[model samples]
Target: MIKTNYHTHTTRCKHAVGSDEAYVLAAIEAGLDEIGFSDHAPWPKHPLEEHFIRMHMDEYNDYVQSVLRLKRQYANKIKIRLGLEAEYFEDRMEVLKKFIDETPLDYVVFGNHFHQLEINGRYYGRYQKTNQLLEHYEHDSIAGLKTGYYKIFAHPDLFVRSINQWDEDVANMSRRIIQCAKEMGVVLEYNLGGIRNFSHVDLAYPYDPFWDLVAEIGADVVIGVDAHDPEDFLDFDSIARAEKILEQKGINVLERLAF
Candidate 1:
């Protein structure tokens, strides 16, 4: 049985559709020790912005309340952690500090998916997604790691997400980020979503190529299925595949899943 899942989502996040209680019950059957409810933060609505959203702040608070209540109700059953899978928006370190300071958070997982990528003459977040370099991720992600606000830097190898390249610049930047996060005691996460969501031929975020530098640097690390729904909780096959990949790199860790 897996220990925990630190990357789970609930139906309240809008994009995901499953009851929070259902996920918790599944974790019990899966023999998970902990589960982090890290729903995404809400994106403001606009006529142009129709597809992106997370959970309302009020609803998020209610979620925390419910989880807390369940933790007491379950007591010896499971350990539920309150967290947010937040975006590393450009120029939002203070917002990070404020959010954590005000909220009762066990941890925060940072991802830089907000880059502006042009699509059909418009932008999809803005690298044209054409494999060009992005300053948002290169700079913002590094900054977030430096802020010392997270327990784990969710996906350390997001560099190849846009370019699918693993050359000099890629290696250099990755080394810097891993080194910085390692110094801060923030473990870098080697995610298995690439195995589950993106095929071996696809350009996956936290690309497998990145494990080379991560292992080379001897950075503290963890493996997560990046599980979203109940069906994915404590999925040992994905976890085993992730471990095998890391083992090929000669990097090993006893990580428990927690979302």
Candidate 2:
């Protein structure tokens, strides 16, 4: 009975599909009580001339206005909140903090996609079976949670995609991450986007071993549609399966985000 999702994306992210308004309509039709548009946040002064993963700094206002407009338009039908999915690049965190401070965002979800910056950093999902990547990922994750800026950690087991087999090191890494999230009281998102898009890929996210640790540790958990397209909200089959899995594991999914 999870009625809310806070990890939705908009077309501004470039890789995502559907209009902002269409997402609202789809969520309403699918019976979601609330939805948050957490499209990827564009970094200021990023080294790349063009990054397809996120919107440019210049487009920030239009993104905000569009979500705000939809929030108003769908007030009676559904609840819409404004947010951004951002990374914790240690060097550029000051800029990120400033951007968040000046914006009208309701919340921010932590997507530990890269080691640091997308331009020069390694993608966490495509790593070697080495401890270095895990070290970096663990470092970034803990540091980001310590900031208390991000409410939900999207795809916390994202590092599992790197290795072919799960081992003790991976288990210990999972424990540290799960324990940190529990200590900080941050929500760990079971991202549906992983199930929808990468289920067939070689990637191993939505990884069961990581979630088993989550269930054992009793960390806060939530399901993120991570909706790139509006129609993603209507995939009740995947949602049901995810809910049943978490529930069977004794993981109590949060029905609504306090935000």
Candidate 3:
């Protein structure tokens, strides 16, 4: 079973529920060996703070300290690691690099939530049918992998959320992402959060075709709960479904993360 979840979020992210310790305690109850606190990275300088879904910049330090304290407190019960789930922007690479360098995080998972920084720009929150959006998603995702800053790539097939069908364009894009991940030596994550948020009928990610391509490419894969709520840490149904998909695809899902 996948015992380590590195994509956990906390109340600091605003959207998630429960305290940092609540997540840790729940992970322990769920029998998780390791849980990484990866709340949304703060972008204080960004102009979209009003529309941002992450924790405020002022709360960044408090988030880190809380995780660090839990790491020590739960040393005997479970392993805890501090991390961040961040979006990638080509022009803001230095800003991301500075945050990663300054913060004592164990890792950062690349979540390409937006294509670029445009005033009131459309992000993955809403679905659109434009091919340009698909291309931007592909380009930005590949660029994020090339940076080599993130150890794991979260929801590599998130572009499917906008795509209603798995056409040749979708397949080609999936191939590129899989190949890029293989070449960059990045671990691709099978996100279970999709199952919880979107119905199986409308779900765009954790898409089967994407993982089938991953199996063909022979890329390394990991399962992340993407836990935003405390109860999410113990979501067995989503985990089981994700595992079933991985099994059917013949993808190798790591039981534990090495780093």
Candidate 4:
């Protein structure tokens, strides 16, 4: 059974909803042992570029404080952690490293969402299907995990959302990425948010072929609620669906994170 989720979000990200406390309460109600609030991380100098998807730099302190407060308040009820769902922006990684070094974050999940930078980078989910896109996605995914900063890789097969058909390129990319994560010991998430938001035919991630490759590679995985709302934590149907599918695939699903 999956008892912990580290891919949760917050209102600070602009795209997620629910009070920070509500998420904790819901998780507790749902019998979760631990939960990590990984709201979209903010860049140091780029304040307003992606405010629609992430929090502003000014709101960073409050976001951290909120999670810390919740962590303390509900210490006995549930294990709450402070974290960020960050994209590995190669150029400003130093800034991220400096910030992580300075903050009290418990973990950071690498969300390989964009090509290079969200400021002008292509959104992988909405890209035109091409080998170059797959190559960039593959390259960035591997490089980000090597950074040693991210504990989990969120939606590793997210690049497939743009493609209509699976081919050798997709299969090879999936195999290499899965093998890389296994070697790095980074946890790959089977994202429930994708299941909740998009139909089976619509969302490419939690992609069947990709997950099949994970099983074949013997890579370990964790099921992430990827909760955008408190109600999302209560969506037992989607959670069960993910659990059933993962079980059927004979995947190695971790009930809790190692670190």
lDDT of 2 by residue, 1-259 (tens): 5689998998888998888889998998888889999999888655653566899889989999999999998798899999999998888788678767998889999998886667534778886435588788899999998998898999999888787688898799889988998898889999898888777875477988788999999998999999999989999988987898898899968888886
RMSD in Å for candidate 2, one decimal? 1.7
Steric collisions counted per model: 16, 0, 0, 0
Estimate TM-scores for all models. Answer: 0.85, 0.95, 0.94, 0.95
Query: Per-residue CA lDDT of candidate 1, range 1-259, in tens?
Result: 3476777777776667667788888788888877777777554333444434466645766877877777787768888887777766544456557768987888887655554221222221224545445444667667777777777777666556566456787778778888888788777777766567665655565576677888898887776656566777656687777777778888756556343
Q: Superposing all C-alpha atoms, what RMSD in Å does each candidate have to the true structure?
A: 3.4, 1.7, 1.7, 1.7
Writing each residue's lDDT as its tens digit, candidate 4 over 1-259 gives: 5688998999988888888889999999888989999999887655535546888888999999999999999999999989999998888898679768999998899898877667544788877545578878888998998898988999888887877688897899889988998899899999998897775565477788889999999999999999999988889999999999999999999999866
lDDT (Cα, 0-100) at 93 in candidate 2: 89
Q: Which ranges in model 4 have alpha carbons more than 4 Å from their true place?
A: 45-48, 119-121, 128-131, 200-203
**Alpha carbon lDDT of residue 251, candidate 1?**
76
Off by over 4 Å in 2: 48-50, 128-131, 201-203
C-alpha-based local distance difference test score of model 2: 0.86
Q: What is the number of residue pairs that collide in model 4?
A: 0
Residue lDDT tens for model 3, 65-103: 999999999999999998998888777678678878998
lDDT of 4 at 83: 92
Model 3 root-mean-square deviation: 1.7
| TM-score of candidate 3 versus the correct structure, residues matched by position | 0.94
